[model samples]
Target: MNADRAETVAILALGWLASNDELGPVFLGSTGASAEDMRRGATDPAFLASVLEFLTMDDAWVTAFCDATGVGYDEPLRARYTLPGAEQVHWT
Candidate 1:
């Protein structure tokens, strides 16, 4: 759950999706993210977390991304929570 490592994995996952012509367009369209946004997000932990969250939205996409990047499917779940400000708040 290291934030640095999570950000790296998130970037790699985004790159994996971007490499696909079909999925790339879909991802960009769905996120409304341009190339500039992706570049900026590469250095932003919060934005990277959002990327991981976006990827986790689809089971099929998650499987494909994991297979392509050799990252475990559960990695995204761990990553999103690891990002700064992502901690769960529990009030009892």
Candidate 2:
């Protein structure tokens, strides 16, 4: 995914997370981001990358977000790597 498409996916994921009552607080707590912070972070690629990181941590979250957003299940991970600080690690 290109940066723009990745950002769009991240934004979709953010919207999904925001509307999820159960996961919304969990995300905020995990990231230490307040509602205000999230609002402000929407346009920040690094912050959006964090959002993708949080979503990709759990398969269920990924599935739910993908399902809700009508995106492919693998899109979040692809989008994450395209963002600011999500380079894939190699242990070879």
Q: Relative to the true structure, how large is the alpha-carbon lDDT of every model?
A: 0.82, 0.92
TM-score of 1: 0.84
What lDDT tens digits, residue by residue, belong to model 1 across residues 49-70?
8788888888998888888889
Summed backbone clashes in each candidate are 0, 0
Show where candidate 1 strays beyond 4 Å.
Answer: 89-92
Poorest 10 consecutive residues of model 1 by lDDT?
Answer: 13-22
lDDT of 1: 0.82
**Per-residue error (Å), model 1, residue 83:** 1.1
Model 2 per-residue lDDT at 49: 96
Q: Model 2, stretches more than 4 Å misplaced? A: 88-92
Q: Look at candidate 1 and tell me the lDDT of residue 86.
A: 73
Per-prediction TM-score, please? 0.84, 0.93
What does candidate 2's lDDT look like per residue over 14-49, in tens digits?
A: 888988999999999998999998888899999999
